[model samples]
Target chain A: MQIYLPIAEMSVSVLLILGMGMAVGFVSGLFGIGGGFLMTPLLIFLGIPPAVAVATQSAQIVASSTTSALAAWRRRALDVKLAGVLLIGGLMGTALGVWFFAAARRAGQLELVIVISYVTLFSVIGGLMLKESIKEFWSTRKGAVRPPRRGGQHPAYMRLPLRVRFYRSKIYVSALPVLGLSLSIGFAGAVLGIGGGFILVPALLYLFRVPTAVVVGTSQFQILWTTLAALVLHAVANQAVDAVLALLLIIGGVFGAQFGARAGRNLRADLFRLLLALLILAVGVRFAVELVVRPTEPFSLVVSEMRE
Target chain B: MRFGLALLLCLLAAGPAGAETLVASLSTSQVRITSNYTGSQIVVFGAIERDAQTVARAGPYQVVVTVRGPRQAVTVREKSRTGPVWINGPQQKFVQIPAYLGVFASAPIADIATPGQRGRLRIGLQASVNAPDITMDRGTEDDRFREALARLKIKELLFIEDERGTTFLTPSLFRTPVPLPVTAPPGDYEVDVTLFADGVLLARAGTSFEVIKTGFEQRLAEFSTEWAALYGLGTAAVALLFGWLATVIFRRD
Candidate 1:
């Protein structure tokens, strides 16, 4: 059951890796999240080198995002124009992210940055989701008049710049902020080896007032491109992408995605958000505890490039 | 014929009288690292070949066997809690740290030889690593860093030391088995067998083996290193293709 990963230079159990992929893929499908927030930590815990884990996880994200996004597209849930603009910004961010990643790696701070970013982002995002979902649940129970306009209702902000219409989401917003938002998301995705869907989905819903149905598809589209950029950058710059490990993950991920997308349709929005928030919080707390607790072994090792 | 005889006699006169000799061989010299290679076991068997000094003449024999992989540089860092978070603190850079090391001795390493002798021969973990390049002068801090490196390597199962790892079939013949984990770096590895008798060095023998990647695994590693840009493009293209294929095949109306 053990397989040797050439790039990672380690032997790992086949079933264990597959199971990890399936679990993460399922989450990806269920919530339209890239699942990197969970998968990257799990891979690191399983002894995969941090660089290889991050780079390889991006490949897996590419596969799962495609699977789920295609399904959404078939259902006419995607805002093609909006996703395209996001893709352009994402590519720009990817370039910057790759440069930053290389610098951090050379300084031996890549792992620390990854852990800190995950803890900070997950806690903030999770806290917001939890609060919002609780209020939404109560509002529905009380049958109160729901706010029809959320993100698109900002009249003053909408008046400031050249507006572009997103026909699918039924909004006229300035392309500048949309481009800026995607740049940040893309930067995060490349650097963190994530789809950035956790942030993207919520941003689309609250910031742009994108329809929930369109949000998932559009984020998936952006995720696919951003992760592809990350995959290429890591492979070229670090040579850390383990092809065998990525294949194993994709095998499990592709199958799990279908079932996840199907099941997601049956879940209530408030309940789904609550579950996602809890999951994110769990990961954040685990990271925070690791940072606070004294390590069993205070010493660590790194192989430096051999002098010629 | 007369010149040959004189030359032989001259060589013999210059050589030590009744010197004990050692001969060794590995079960296999080349370890082929295939795609499914998780690890490998190499059986190192050697014998103390006696010439003028018979087995009975010399004291009971002892053998110490060690296999060292290619040398490389490594950085060791220590982490300490800063406020609510743990961060890397002091760091040391060490050159000539072997990527892999396995030492097996028939008897306790301490019992085999004197500390000075061990250090001279680079026999054990403590004696093997060269002095690290520590910029700051902190007494005993260098030793602490070196020890930490050994401990961390041991925890990873990369560096191993077994006092009774070598088993003797006969008084002069011995065998030791070393398991090379998948994490073992691929390179030329030198195997050294030192023969000892009553804490006195008898003879020494050395041989080398290679751990190399083969087939697709070899080619892939090479391509990634040699033509990284192409490799990156290929990896991205393949991943994207696979994603597209999955989407198309699993498409639902």
Candidate 2:
């Protein structure tokens, strides 16, 4: 059935929107990430206005990440203290990001900025994940069980003031890097309409050497809060969130996440990492291609602020 | 579109003294956009009135009806290759242009009136979009931008022209359906009807209709802007509730 979206000022097929949410949610569940990066582009490809697409998907991310975060909490995989620290900066960054988003829209550069950031972010994070996962996959195939290493010397950059021991991740690092990392990622996430979990998971894994299992849970917890903040900010600042669209997507997402989580449990660890890494790279390449390629219709439209 | 309202006939104009005058009205004064509103069509119905001393001297009369939605500010941007990426290039900002425009005619527009005459009356699609204040840099490049804007609007069905859209039921009565596309902005829509005979402008009549959201849709739009903080929280709450419910039903841990 076709339903009108009030904020978007468009009519879209309910089934089509539901299907998009289901597919994106399945990825979110399987990877334990919010999958906002995937869903935002898909929404725009389906012809929802970019402002509405970005704002509405922020709300959808809250729904998907909440499921992943709760599941991780139940499994005792999530670190609540770490999430609390991350959120302190994440919320601050999200507020700044929303203001930047409004400024970019007024300048008619929002889409260009979004595409460029997507290509740059995914290429870096996806490349890193692919390299690490490939190394682990081949080592395991050679029947070499990974050996436990002695506690390593702290990375030089991490030795800063205000040290804290994150009991869950079993790491002692300066809180500055943690706050800075999340704050930067939060700003990037809010602008790009993503949960930033794809970047967060690998950053935790590589920089702080967070345990892989804990990384997914902790990142999901962080995504849940940041995206909730983004949703609220976009709604209040831009007034562009489509309530109808968000509701439809959430309904489908809840069902898809259940099936994906079940499927994820059966996958081998090394193989799961390899698959997710490749998927992230593919989406990054898609955005890169869109940038350089000559568009079929080069003209676009925008409604400026109301003229009194 | 309905006609035969002889009692409501008011003389709008006459080509000469005491000649035939045009009288017109619309099917509805307001179009309510409900949840299921895909699009709508408004019928413009009219009649020809003549006094006791008047005479029908010329060929068959022609009717041209134009419906223009509320004036809106818009910017049209064109993308061009810049380095390895394509970015918005030259842009044109229109301070006031019809968000929705549709034109209906009893005959082919070209046959009804000459291009110059049509342009003067601002009767056709080309004339409707042309406003001197809209284009500041009047060059071929700016022309391309304006044409591109029209093309884009036409592609979206926001600009429409249907020759033979209006039909005459009798010698004095006529009606036409002016389609308002799904994307039509909600506001006042001006409907102008013109009469032509032998390529000469004869009579003119103007009416208007309003496009408005129904109570439910109106409230939703207003609440999003007025109570934005609450609206934002409510959407988030719904998401959180759904998330919690999913875990209850599907949790494996």
Candidate 3:
């Protein structure tokens, strides 16, 4: 059950990697997120080089997101026009992210920046989700007035300069904040080497008041394309993609995604949000603890380049 | 690298080589890294051969075997806690140092050879790391950074030393095993077997082997670098294929 990864230059247990992939895939299907936020860190923890782990993970993300994204699309739950705008902003962010990533690396603070960003993103996003979901759960139990879902009840800040109508979400909101939201998401995604699905899903629901189900589909659609772009970039820049490893992950991931998507439909939206909020906070707390605890080994080695 | 070994062998043979000359062979000269390759061990079997001018010695002969993997540049970075978080501080780069180094001796290297002799011959782990070839990127060889590098490598199972790793089968014959960890990179590795008696170097012999990725692993690694874009597209296609298959099997809408 031991297999050697070609590009990563490491030997890993097949079953262990399969299990990790399946777990991420389940998250992908259930939440309509790429799950790269979890998968990348897990890969690095298993001793895969950071560069290789980041590059190779895109393939797994593509597989997981596509499985759920395509399903949502077939069910007519995805918003293509909205996702398209987000894609444009994401691409712009990717270019900026890569340049900044290189600069941070040159300063030898890339690891610090990545860890800090992870802690900050996870806590803020997870904290807000938990708070809102708890309130939503209680309000429903009391039979109180539900939060507004239809568009046009916009706050002053959301009423930006240019207005565009999204027919699917029934929103006549400005495109500026939407574009800006995606731009920042993309930048964060590139810096963290993740798909940004977790953040995207929540942002769509809170900011645009996108329907619960549609938010899943749209975020997944966006994740699929961004991960594909990332895969190609890593390939061209570092040639770090390990095809064999990715294939193993995909085999397990696709199976897990099927079951997870089915389970997602049966679960209530409030309960789903509660679980996701817990998961996100758990990951955040884990990283935070790592930062505080004294490391067993404080020195690490980085090879300059591979030699033939 | 092979030429360097050959030159070292010639110089050793031409040196004050007494009657006894070391002869050595390897269990495997080429390790093909297949899909199932985790790690492996290679044995060094050698004998002492003497010519007509052979003479009996007052003390028993001791053997020391050193196996070194290919040289590579590695940057060792140090991290110190800043408030609640530990952040990387100053770093040093080890230029063209052996990626893997293992020393196996019949007795403790220090017990068998004097510090001066060990340093001159690069016979032990300390001498190997502190050899004249080792150079840092910045500042002096502040013992702290170099020690940390050695310590980390040892923890990773890349740098090793076993005082009793070598054993003598008979008076003039011996054998030792060199272990290659899963992390061992594919490269050319050199094996040096030195004969010592009463803290004096007698004879030395050297051999080499290669660790290479063969069959599927080899081609995939090459394809990724040579046809980078195509490789990426191919992996993406496979993912898409799997994803589509999932949808078909679990169709529910």
Candidate 4:
């Protein structure tokens, strides 16, 4: 069935949109990722306007992240104190991100900026993940487990001020780096229409040396807030969010997430990481190709209200 | 027999002296874009009244109907390779361009009228709308952008021309269907029907129809424009509520 999206001023197949949401949600569930980066581009490819696609996916992220955050909280895995600090920076970062988004849209540069950022972000993150996961996979083949080290904290972080103690993660460090990291991530997430979990997870685990379990839970908790902030910002600032599109995606996402979470339990961690890393790298490369490649139709149209 | 003569006499009396009389009506006066609206078609039907002397002097008649949507500002951008990546290059900002334009004629437009006549009457798609104002440096490059804009709009089906789109039911009666695509913007649309014979405009009539958003669609558009902040906050709140509800219902022990 075709449904008219009022905000986007377009008609799209309900089944197609549902399928996209379900597929993205399934991947998100299996990987414990927000899936906004995947969903936004897919929506654009399916004919949703780029701005609307980017903004509307933020709402979907809020729902998905909230579900996972609540689950983590119930399991006593979430670091609430850490999430609180992250959100303080997150809100401030979202404000800056939204401003930049609105300005870029007016300048007719939003789409280009989004593509470039995605290309750069996905390549770097995917490359590192692929490298780390492959190392682990090969080590396992030798039938020996390596002793884990819990000492990856950067010495440079000690000089920062506003020291805070996080009981859940058992870390005593300056809040500055945490705030700065989340602020930058939040700004990038809002602009890219993601929860910043992909970046946040690695940053927390590798840079702060936070335990994997706490990192996962805290990342989800913080994503819930940042994506919510982005959703509200895009709506109010750009009026880009489509309620109908968001609703359709949520319906499919909820069901798909259940199946994905179930299937994820049977998958080996090393295999999952390898697959995710490849997927991320693939998306990044696609964007890079789009940038350098000559387009079939070089001209694009932008319709605006007549300003007399 | 007496009534027939009276009708003929009335027709002659109603038509302007030594000229044809054209009367037109649209199938609908308003197009409502509801939540389920995908696209719509409007039929324009009309009758031409002419005296025997005029009919004998002129050849078979041709009817041209045009439907023009509301005017709006637009920006068209062309991309070119800059360094390793392609980016926007020359840009044109048009003050006003019709969101939709459809031209339908009984026969091939070229056969119906001369190029001069076509330009004067703005008959075909190319001549119907004037080139929009360009903001950047005015030169031949701006004209290229203008043509590119028209081409892009044509590709989108927002601007169209169908030479044989109109059909004649009788020598004096004609009708045509003007299709409005799903992307057609909602606003006032003007429909013009012109009758021509021997490369001369015999008569013309004009009417308009409105395309409007209705029901929930209307309310949503209005709210988004009027109360953006509230709408945005509401969207976030509702999304959160939905997420919370899903968590409550779907949570496993």
Candidate 5:
């Protein structure tokens, strides 16, 4: 079916939108990224209003994460207690982010912020990925196995009140750290219109050294709340959420998430990281091009009230 | 047979006084006026040929015009029922529906006076609806107008038809003759004309028009000004807050 979007005045075929959703879902599942980094840009390219695109993406994230989280729980890999602590922090961060968004709107400086942030973040992430991929290629030529970090005592000073053990992750951490992580992910999730799965997964794996099996599950757990909070904030604060568009994307994402989770189980860790690096690089480069090339007319659908 | 001859004799009697052709046309042939409105309006106008028939009836005519468009089209037909209706404000809210004011005719169209020798009536059009005790401010009025235009589904052009004649016009071509009164309620409205023959239903023509508080250019400017600062501060605040929380939660253990 084809539907005409009112704001964009474009005919969007359901099949095309579904295909895009499925493709993003597959990548998200394979690499454990929330897919917002790709989805938002793609929607903008397709002429969806930026605000609507972000809000709708949040709605899709809720569905995608819900499906993925359920599967991870079935595998006995989710650390629910840890996720709870993070969620607490995430909730606070989302509130703060929304406040900041409103302030920026009033100040009339949202676009500059968006452009600068995109360029800086993408360039850094993309450079890192290019470096990692080159290193991997060199390591293959050397034909030497990368040594794993030797087990060592847990660091002090990182300790917080309410220490708890995660049976699934086989680790003990203070609720403070979990709460802090959740807050950070929550803030980022709200601002970027992502579920925070991509960031959370990396934080868990590298910073916390959580086992690979638990990483995806914990990330999904965190993302579920992050996406949900973002969705609610966008709907209430900006009135940007389009329920119909969100429903369509969610329908495609649900099925895709199931397939993605199944495929995720068999993927190699290094290969997954490489794919994530490449995807981030692609997104970063795209944003970079947009920032540098000055268009004759500003590329945007939003009409400002100041012009009148 | 006697009646038929009498009608023919009447026609012959009226045919010779330098007959003028009065051609009437509407901007759109079909319109969808939502029932959520008290009443709606449209515009109907056309050129009169120099040699067409002309009538000397002044403004007042009990005109009944039936407008048919898509069934899903919401016309300005509102009932006095108590229910929740969405109201546009700083924050959109659902309020108990009030008695919606129906359509109002601004001026009993003065007269279909012939233009020079031509039987053309090039007259300005205006209509309004009132909602007493209902605040019809600029914002609300624009919102209602936008909603009506959206319902009109006029992508490129609209066709108008009536007993006088039928005409097609693009939305961009129609011009507003007067400024919209600030007190007007938020509702659908159009410029329209009603035709009457011996005080009976003849034809009606109209076209959808909108009154916007802010033009397109102004909106673009405001968006650009606000977008830059907000996006940056919002992004950083988010990144830092989330980063700190992540550090606190996932410390090395």
Candidate 6:
């Protein structure tokens, strides 16, 4: 069953990587999140180097996002104009992120920074989602308001230049907020080597008060570009991409994304958040353990003289 | 005068009376080393031969090659193999060592050496081995020894295995015997080959090679050119800020 991959230079069957991609892609589609957060760690566990896994995962995200975004767009759920504005910010943020990433590498603290950021962000976000889901579950049992909507006036601080009205979401928000959110997600995407759809989906749903229907589509739209940009940058700068591994994951992810998008329609907002939170916490803890624990023996490889 | 004549006659009788002529040759005298972002493996080949019958018994020799330059020294060794193999019909028979094809060892390089400089190294050849088996038919003991041999790493095992029995070492005919990087620092190095028979050193030989550096700065310039995109993006961020600021300042009420 072993096949030697030309790019990876390792004996790994395509089927095995595809199966892993399908599982991760399913979750990504269902939750409107990029599965890079989970897939990268899993690849590393399977002995792929961290840099290769991240680069390959970025390529896989393109497949997953395109498949899911198509479905959400067909449902009349995408806000194209808004997503465009966000992309402008995302592109700028990604540039800054790469510079920061290179600086961190030179400082020899890249791993520590990535580990700490993942744990802190996931812990806070996951805890909030779990609490909200529990409250929503109890309220539903008591036959409380079905899909409760906020009634208070929107915050004034959110106002800025380039005000745009989104008719479907029934809101007029400044482009500045959208741009700022995109930049933040873009920075996260670049540093963590993820698609940043997880953060974008939640921000659109809650902070921008975009309808849940439009959030998935718009987030995917922005994520697609961001992931592509990151992939190109990583490839050019670090030569980190492994095309063989990326193709293996994409084949399964494309199909899984479709099913996930379909299931996403039925899931409640609080429940989806809850699942995301739990996944983030689990991955965070695993990363923490790796940083804390040291291996028994340290081995070094000796490089012989190179032949002309 | 009689004592002096006796001494001269004794010296003449003992010197070069029954010396065995052995020659060591490689396939190639020069090897080029290139920069590798990832690790690479290189092969070295050579052989040794003795004059017919003059070499009554030869074996268990060590070949050592040292890479010299930049305060770092790398050495490679080939150890002799001795064990039992299961033959036809479940019978265990000890195989004789092959004589034509000698030892082959591969070394993996994880990092590229600083290249573009000519360096010299020495290759030394010597004979060394453990005591031979005492029993005529050590069946179970030979099995145990084989098992132990299997557990040893590549560095521990010296002989190359094939369908035939073990043979005496032979010179490798490959074009490049050593893997040298283009960025290798300039220095002198040596290669040593030794022949041993039953733990006794019989003959030794050595050779040398040099590493030279060339066109290093030009390569660095190309690297900087490719990396300019990162710098371009950083400076453009300020332009983006200014555009945003202009939009805010020139907004229509």
Highest TM-score model number: 3
Ranking by lDDT: 3, 2, 1, 4, 6, 5
- Residue range B124-212, candidate 5, lDDT tens digits: 11111121111233444444433332232222122121222222233111111221222222223434443333322233345543322
lDDT of 3 by residue, B141-172 (tens): 55677888789889889999999999999989
1 or 6, greater by DockQ: 1
| lDDT: worst 10-residue window of model 2 chain A | A299-308
Docking class of 5: incorrect
Report, in order, each candidate's fnat. Answer: 0.67, 0.72, 0.76, 0.73, 0.00, 0.01
For candidate 6, report its TM-score. Answer: 0.60
What pairs collide in candidate 3? none
Q: Evaluated with DockQ, which candidate comes out highest?
A: 3
Candidate 4 regions with alpha-carbon error over 4 angstroms: A95-115, A150-163, A170-172, A190-194, A261-267, A306-308, B1-18, B52-55, B129-137
lDDT of 1 by residue, A175-290 (tens): 88888888887787667766678888888777777777788788877787777777887888999888889988987887777678778878877687788788877878887888
Instruction: List chain A TM-scores, every candidate, in order.
Output: 0.88, 0.88, 0.93, 0.84, 0.84, 0.88
* Cα TM-score per model: 0.90, 0.90, 0.94, 0.88, 0.57, 0.60
DockQ scores of the candidates:
0.53, 0.58, 0.71, 0.52, 0.03, 0.04
DockQ leaderboard ranking: 3, 2, 1, 4, 6, 5
Q: B-chain TM-score, every candidate?
A: 0.87, 0.88, 0.90, 0.87, 0.25, 0.32
Tens digits of per-residue lDDT for model 3, A61-169: 8887888888988988888999999999988887888889999999978989998999999988999999999988899989998765554567774688788777776
lDDT, residue B242, candidate 1: 69
Displacement of the residue B129 alpha carbon in candidate 1, Å: 3.9
lDDT of model 2 at residue B91? 80
lDDT of 2 by residue, B1-253 (tens): 1222321232222235326578999999999988777888889999987777866656888889998888878888888887899878778887777888888999999999888667667788877667566655566676777788789889889988889889999977999988887788788999989888777666778999998888778899999999999999999999999988989988554
Model 2 alpha-carbon drift over 4 Å, by segment: A92-114, A153-162, A190-193, A306-308, B1-18, B52-54, B135-140
lDDT (C-alpha) at residue A201 in model 6: 73
User: How many clashing pairs does model 4 include?
Assistant: 0
TM-score of 4: 0.88
Can you give the lDDT of residue A148 in candidate 4? 64
